[model samples]
Target: MTTALTLTTGQDQDGAPVLVAAGEIDMSNAERFTAALSEAITDRREPLVVDLTAVEYLDSAGLAALFHHADRIEVVTGPLLSPLLAVSGLADLTTVRTR
Candidate 1:
């Protein structure tokens, strides 16, 4: 079964566009994640803030989707997923803020 993923669009304290994601992000829901990323960046020039602080898991498919948008996005993640992002080399490609 597909893991539950929720995507919500909002602004950060600094008024940057933020996409808050919660739940597991695997092959089953990676497409939806990609779509959300696309929508978040539409007509926007500044880097999109992807708040994955509440996300519990992220698989290869999800990581691929993130890689596609690395140049145009910044990531905010919790401690649990910080190592994964670093190990995946995403931390080198963009700004990753751990909270």
Candidate 2:
């Protein structure tokens, strides 16, 4: 079963786009996350900043979604690391900034 993933959007002081995601991102819900990101970038024409601080887990499907849109999005996460991106070897390919 696909768990519900929470996605929130906001802008920085300079109008930079930001998306805050809080939930598990696995095969079941990867599409939902991708759709949310697609919506965030549609028409707005701004680089996306994804805050994965509250994300507890991530999987290959989630990484694929991010890779598909790697050029348009920047990812930021909290210190506690999850091996999903690292194991997928996308930590360097995408804009994943850890805090």
Candidate 3:
């Protein structure tokens, strides 16, 4: 597919898992995003923090990927994505922090 998305998984200073995403996340790359997210969900108990600060664009397919695993994932967002997260009701399923 297209190289419009990038995903990386690592631990934060506190050892919490973090998934960093960048580039456009739309129908073209949603599957890639979903696969990355699925692989990142290694710990079913602990929350997975997704840093979307670098995500410049997102669409329903991309958002649905998050919703599919919203129960175990937390979101780190910004003005660009916060409103969409809230409007899509994803904010209710998990903690969404604005940055």
Candidate 4:
């Protein structure tokens, strides 16, 4: 069975676009995540902040989706964040800010 990734979009305190991604992001749902992000960027031509605090896991396909839009994406995570990116060796490909 294919799992679905849920993405919630909203604005931050400064009114910047923010996307909250929860659940697992793997081969099963990387394409859906990418499509949602693409739609968000197309709707708002500004930098997008992605909150990964609730993400439990991420795979190579998910990392690729994030890196594909790294130029305009910012990753935010809480303390004790998952080391999915590190395991995938994509820690240098994207900006991950700890909160």
Off by over 4 Å in 3: 1-3
TM-score of 3: 0.92
Give the backbone clash total of model 3.
Answer: 0
State the TM-score for model 4: 0.80
Encode model 1's per-residue lDDT on 39-96: one tens digit a residue: 9984667799999999999999999999999999999999999999999999999999
Local error of candidate 3 at residue 64 (angstroms): 0.6
Could you give candidate 4's per-residue lDDT for residues 6-81 as a string of tens digits? 8999889988888899888898888889998887663556688889888877778888888888888888976645
Which residue pairs of candidate 2 clash? Answer: none
Task: Find the candidate with the highest TM-score and give its number.
Answer: 1
lDDT (C-alpha, whole model) for all candidates: 0.94, 0.80, 0.90, 0.78
RMSD of each candidate relative to the true structure: 1.4, 2.5, 2.1, 2.7
**How many clashes does the backbone of model 1 have?**
0
Q: Put the candidates in lDDT order, highest first.
A: 1, 3, 2, 4
lDDT tens readout by residue for model 3, 1-99: 444788899988988889999888999889989998888887556889999988988899999999999988999988999999999999999999999
Looking at model 3, residue 39 earns an lDDT score of: 86
* lDDT value for model 2: 0.80
TM-score to native of every candidate shown: 0.93, 0.81, 0.92, 0.80
Off by over 4 Å in 1: 1-3
